[model samples]
Target: MTTYAIAHLHQTELCAEIVEYLEKIDGTLAPFGGRFIIHGGRVEQLEGKFRGNLIVIEFDDRERARTWYRSPAYQAILPLRTRHASGDVFFIDQVAQPHRATDILEGIRVPTAGVAP
Candidate 1:
């Protein structure tokens, strides 16, 4: 399954630190099969409220996404981000295929045979 690193920054300060973070983040991702899908693009609020920038990175799986975030390479430069902005960071695994609401509901209707059925 694919995973995404979703970063929603609420406050940001443009400075040399951000510059360095941008410059080096790609290099850190290359080794872990991670790539930027969205990098500070213009965000249009359709329904609710949102602030600052949204960065989405795709990785091979949840483990790789976690590893990339915790790796020494990324950890070393994390302070730069923390120093400039603050927001939510998390990983979400993507569904392998599109499914209807009923299909998803059926998936949770019964427990597994061995576990709790």
Candidate 2:
């Protein structure tokens, strides 16, 4: 399954360090087949308030995503971004194709009133 590394970065500083991070990040991602699907583009806010930039990088699978994140090349440059930005970063698996909105319910277990969950 495809997986994504998503980040919502706020209060980012456009400093020399950040510039360097941007220049070098591509090299780190190439070996892992990770590419940016979204990178700080203009957002159309339809509902709740949103702050800062949203970044999404796609990977072949969860394991590849995990490995890319943990790789030394990526780790080495992580501090460059971390020192200049404040945000949330996480990995999420893509949903299967030909799916329904209710498909997720199958993996969720609701406890019966008399049973311990």
Candidate 3:
């Protein structure tokens, strides 16, 4: 299954370190087949407030995504972005096709009758 590395970066500093990080990040991702699906483009907000930039990188699978994140190349430059930006970063697996909105309910362990959840 495809996996994504998503980040919501706020209060980013456009400094020399950040510029260097941007230049070198692609090289780190290439070996892992990771590519940017979204790179902080303009937003067309239709709901609640949003600020800062959103970045999404796609990987072939969860293993590849995890390996890339832990690889020395990515780890080397990790501090560059961390030092200049504040935000959230996480990995998420893509849902399978022919899916329903409630498919996630299957993973929930519903409380048994008369038992506390």
Candidate 4:
């Protein structure tokens, strides 16, 4: 299954170290078949609080995602991110096919013959 690395970054210090980190991150991820799907684009918050940048990365599988994060190459540059920004990162497995609301609630015995509320 495909895996994803999602991050909600906050409070960036944007320095030379961060620049170095940015320059090297792609090289580090390439070995694990990791690539950025989203990196620093305009964000519109629909709910709750959001700050700083948002990043999403895709990998071949859960193990690949975990391996990339825990690899020595990434470890070497982790401090740059920690020093420059604070955020949350998570790995999630993708569902084979995303469900519609009714499809997701099928277990609840909601009739799918018509629109469900």
Cα TM-score per model: 0.85, 0.89, 0.89, 0.82
Error of 1 at 69 (Å): 1.1
lDDT tens digits by residue: candidate 1, 1-117: 999999999999999999999899999999999998998887878998888888999998989998989999999999998999999998988875776656656646666788965
User: Which residue pairs overlap in candidate 4's backbone?
Assistant: none
- Evaluated at residue 20, the lDDT of candidate 2 is 94
Q: Tens digits of per-residue lDDT for model 4 on 4-115?
A: 9998888789899999999999999999999999998998889998888989999999999999999999999989888888888899887767656566565676556777
Predicted structure with the largest lDDT when compared to the true one = 3
Ranking, TM-score, top scorer first: 2, 3, 1, 4
Q: Which candidate is the best by TM-score?
A: 2
Weakest ten-residue segment in model 2 by summed lDDT = 102-111
After best superposition, candidate 4 residue 32: deviation in angstroms? 0.5
For every model in order, what is the number of clashing pairs? 0, 0, 0, 0
Better of 2 and 4 by lDDT: 2
- On lDDT, the stronger of 3 and 4 is 3
Off by over 4 Å in 3: 107-117
Clashing pairs in 2: none
* Candidate 4 lDDT trough over 10 residues, lowest sum: 98-107
Q: What Cα-based lDDT does every candidate model obtain? A: 0.90, 0.95, 0.96, 0.90
lDDT of 1 at 28: 93
Regions of model 4 farther than 4 Å from truth: 102-117
